[model samples]
Target: MEISKGQSPHTQPNMRTAKVYTALESLLCVNCKQQQIIQNCESFLKLDAQLRNKRARELKVCLNCLRGGHFLSNCNSRSTYKKCHRKHHTLIHLEVNKANETIPIPQQIVNENTITNTSNQTNSTTNLSSSTLNAQTLLSTAMVKVNDTEHNSHQIRVLLDSAFQSNFVSEGLFVPQISSALPTHTFNRNAIEIPPNIKLADPRFNESRPIDVLLGAGIFWSLLSVGQVKVNQLILQRSKLGWLISGELVNQRFISDQTRASFFSLNELDHKLERFWQVDEFTSNDHILTNDEEYCEEYFRKTTTRDEAGKFIVKIPFKASVHNKLGNSYDVALARLKNLERRFETNPVLQENYIKFMQEYQRLNHMSNIENNNDNAFYLPHHAIIRESSETTKLRVVFDGSCKLETGLSINEAQFTGPTLQNDIFSIIARFRLHQYVFTADVEKMYRMVWVHPEHRRYQRILWRETTNDEICTYELNTVTYGTTSAPYLAIRCLIQIALDNQDYYPLESQVIKEDVEYSQEYSSLPSLDMSQ
Candidate 1:
């Protein structure tokens, strides 16, 4: 790439740089790119510096790659012209663009699921890498305005998935039966520049809103036709749904020569979880979830919703089918309540503490009054675990999730106990050494933060009375019952979700919360406390 003149614009053009740049413009594979280097070699060649630089700048292509729409400072391209390595392309000298100033190419992040699912072995890279996962996974998303049952239009964020086979709607959205905000309720959304006079399908294409509807391949191509406007890597095309943007976005913010991403395989976590939580029997070495755990997740996706107050609402994952609905266990619950009363009569202090606990629950609106009907009812008998040594909670009430009826079926037996979704304590503890600054915080009423579905609340009923003088009252736990098998999974899931949704603003803290935090507490080991802000 050595030229006779570095600053002379009248000098000869580098044929090798031209050929290589042409091969790159053609979108050649790595092998072809290598062949491009082999077939056409670079000798002493030079092009007009001022003429070329002006032309390159006008075309908005980086001088290094001569393809990507960027300045020489942000070029991610490299030259292989017989190992004649210079930051800039051979045709354009260093002084032509920015004198000796090299801008590193920004990196793209691969889908976490892609990396996790492909690799299963423990010895770092044990899992199969289907492809180079260094690139970001881009989804074609748009803010779609759809009319509800009342014919009022509301914007719901949608994902245009051309590879998917079907469409889906999130039950969390307050849409009419037909379908599917906050500090971000109204923010300055990012706007992608579209072609003039082209009516955009969705004006707010860059808002970070929740995905409501997922339109698959069947509905994708049908919406888009021949109309397309290119904006760098992004392609804005007209569609039946609206104008949608596809492809990656370049952000100079993350440009760095090095990207240190710790790819902790989910399989590794599963194995570590097994070792951490000792079991009598060995788990399958395949690093896949059990049938019961898989079923629990599938059920959650199909039935989960969000109420007005922003709490995650979930159904009790009942194993019973349509034909095998179990009868009410009211009589059994009544007998247990009577026995509990007898114990309270002897220990008035215990009863007083328990009553206060239940009162606090009612005050927080964590339980609701439900009609005492025998149909499809399963009352959970409860008792208090009094730890006098404990200062904060001397009397903690716990529901008897395993209380069985005459039919020999208990709530625990009839429902799925979802797999542990939280990172093992061992791993979180191990991460403490990675950073210099660390802090921990306990989440208040963690299990009470998540809500259970109203329809399925009947299955979580309990019997209670202020005193023996008062009549027995039936109440269903509105929040996730603490003793229920699925409670941990549900509550931990919410914590993880909070971290994920806010990662854009609080990346380091969110990472700690999502991957490092325990069930109800956060032990965030950050590089510095400043990052938590």
Candidate 2:
């Protein structure tokens, strides 16, 4: 005990017994507010105080331990015992009574069902292993009616689970009421034959009803299982319900279907092949030929286009011809001119068509004459060829850059062939079959669609005139011309650029058409290129 705040350090002893008691009482008086007495060591005074405090505060106590600080729900006790009608945490008879009266036992006895190997009673007291408890906890019950006899049909609870490989019913259901509905095949466990769809009687569930059957995967793929469902006034879509269905059940729901018109048939493929063999009649307005020489001349004056020097030019890389020729041999150019003139004189149809073709070329400004004194200009050998086309009279002009010179160097030899500029043909064909709707169109005058660099244009000089009476004039082809090895590379490269530049304007269409483009070289090795590329 503490003495006094200002007293001596030692406490004085009392000689008399009564005096000792009085002194002890006096010592207790010191710091009375902070003092307490414990009558018995086992009293657990601190615990008593806590209980008292909880009672005073009117706090809840755990039903299991009848102690304060937590509710029955949060209690950590795993012990279970039988009481009124089911398992409980406390013994009713042993609990404290409010009136201190004699406890009277109820007439009804509560039953607890324990899984066992022998007894078939629905509810009976029996020892249960932890595994049994766990299994019971994991099971979910649903009420269902077994199709037995018309007069004996009864509703029972069924376990809906996927653990069992097949569906099963209680063997007790083998009674006359459901015997006729049962199938011959049965499920056996430990030499016992259990009937399908009718098993021995089992306890029913209490939540909604009693459990009677175990529904397994055998019937999961059947109509008994629902593919679509809705609840709580909200519609459930297939995507949401698919999780509940077995993979096999879901897969069985769909079969292969190829009835759509979009499916290309063998006949359609044959037709496509036939079309490939036919002449390509498709023609562009810019390259259309006419029979009037005057009309052709006027068109040339109106539509000729040119590119600014060095601003936007395609680079061409070609190995110099062994001949080392810089310009068209004048003799060769003159010979080609005379050959065309003689053909037109003999074939009137050729003369008229030739005039129209020249006029159109002039209008497009595809060709222009170099200054008479421009000695630096390289002359390109030109020739006219006639071929059978599905459309108008056929005449195509080609530049013969391959002509050999005395030194073994030709125009084509000096130019660059550029890189492999086309896409793989196989890739184009693959994506072509991907879409339901397909569209195809050819670029008119595909090679001439691009302009040559001004510096390079001077090397593409050609000899042309309106008629035999007209003076022979020198002109440079301003665009990529046919018969030039670099034409395909230049045209394809330009096409790729155009598609990339306009992708933002037509994203979907651009992606689809881009797959159709066929380029040359390296393409055959790229087997992974798809529509996106």
C-alpha lDDT score of every prediction, in listed order:
0.66, 0.48
Which runs of model 1 end up more than 4 angstroms from their true locations?
A: 1-287, 322-328
Cα error of candidate 1 at position 372, Å: 1.5
Top-TM-score structure, candidate number: 1
**Candidate 1 at residue 388, lDDT?**
79
Each prediction's number of clashing residue pairs: 11, 46
What TM-score does candidate 1 get on C-alpha atoms? 0.46
